[model samples]
Target: MTEVSNKTAVDPVERAIRRIQSVYGSWNRNTSVAQMRSDWDAAFAGCTVPESCRQASADGVDGEWIVPADAPRDKAILYFHGGGFRLGSIASHRDLIARIADASGCRVLAVNYRLAPEHRFPAALEDALAAYTWLREQDFKPKDIVLAGDSAGGNLVLTAMLSLRHRGEALPAAGVLMSPWTDLAATGESYLSRATADPIHQRSMILALAKGYMGDGGDPFDPLASPLYADLVGLPPLLIHAGDRETVRDDATMLAEKAKAAGVDVELKVWDGMIHVFQMFSEIPQAQTAMAAIASFLRRHLRLEAERVR
Candidate 1:
């Protein structure tokens, strides 16, 4: 069965994503990672910073804390920014994470995890784990925190949780995944089936990215690299958001299925006519709806009540 159907008109943001893909396709593969990073930083430079959020740095991990003027101090969201684990940074994703913090009425710490083709493999994962540990050291109870990420960042969140579980450490109250690329193996049917529909990612592009992040001969299905193949038991509740029009659509579906089969509490949401990481486009109404849903999920899972102002 085809993964994406022409059921609705394409949203303007999806069109924009198509343009981005075209531009990305034109980028010279021989370009240095530093140059690519600089280019991306410029592309997203116009993203407006939210006045409602306070930004900070932690242990060399760039962080942006978005908490309402009256929100609770004990609860937090440790967010990992996504860039195929090679590009993107706190500056690029700050606006989106700020919106999340505002929506959830909880503090959000957007961690600038190390990138690949330089840091590689466990570097991003290690930073994610370290950021979570830093949160714990700051007196945030594990059960009061939530783990959130998109794309490769999503992989980091899941792998970090798995590492914590294997070490018999405290786990977060829940997790939120937005268009997570959980399978580095590129085995998902959507990779081909949704090719025409998804403008943000293509199979060849994705595989090249995976290889860059993993280096030569890296096992693609190593649980950390591909959490789809990981043991899902003992993980906390999860909320996964995906765009029906995206190549990674099956990544979310398959992970949800596996988590459910493992008896983990998992909720999968597939938005029609949406593109990958559509939540990052603040202008899109569906993005707001998705944020509202994420906020509701966080409040429910974290037992957090919106603070009432005097």
Candidate 2:
């Protein structure tokens, strides 16, 4: 993993951090889940979906097609939004997905998978697999598709890929993970080391979210639940972005080491002083750079022709 230093003005990032902290820091066990979901949606309500994208369903699975103008229809990205598997929706992430489509010059399928506490562990994974299967049935070759996700959604990306590999199905061309929560076990030292540094996520909240997804008896170390323990052999190339200040920073770094040892191509970038999934905050210059890097990595792995977007 490489640590990239950003010299951009910190004022914007600080403001973004304060905004996020204000929202996330208010949550507690007393807050109702429905209210939390609504707040999550409202937080990103200002993000406008690009005019070119269209709404579509993936074989009964709720989703939106973020297709940039003139983008090739054959290539697509399967994006999963992060909310600890209990929150987040197409509404909260449509704008970010649109940016990805605009950057990669490819269509993006952002799915609204089943959330947890209401639907348990295998539910989200099953929904993800169904969406991928729908894409395959539409004649989108596995090589032309890329899997991308952030946080808990990133966990889904890994588990979904593992499920496909185990079923003898072909894998996607590559994967892009942003601040992935790979270790449900929560054993990473960053939880302690970065405790004071991370603004939004903390150990207590992480464990609560894990329990909400896993229920009372779910195994934290289960390879399916936590890809940090899963075999990484034969998975497609991965581009992982992480923030050094985030509590899950170790999750990205440790996964990179394991994937590399397992012979999978892995590129891990640790952005100094950024927060979890910092790409969601467009005001931050690092977010723009990160999106560009993601676009370049996808084009290279998918063998798409480089065409400048005006």
TM-score for candidate 1, please give it: 0.91
| Candidate 2 local lDDT, residue 63 | 87
| Candidate 1 residue-wise lDDT, 93-202, digit = tens | 87788777777778888878888888889888888888888888889999999999998888888999999999999999999999998999899999999999886788
Q: Runs in model 2 with CA error above 4 Å?
A: 1-10, 25-28
Worst 10-residue lDDT window for candidate 1 reads 44-53
The prediction achieving the highest TM-score against the true structure is 2
Q: Whole-model lDDT for model 1 versus the true structure?
A: 0.85
Worst 10 residues of 2 by lDDT: 45-54
Clashes of 1: 0
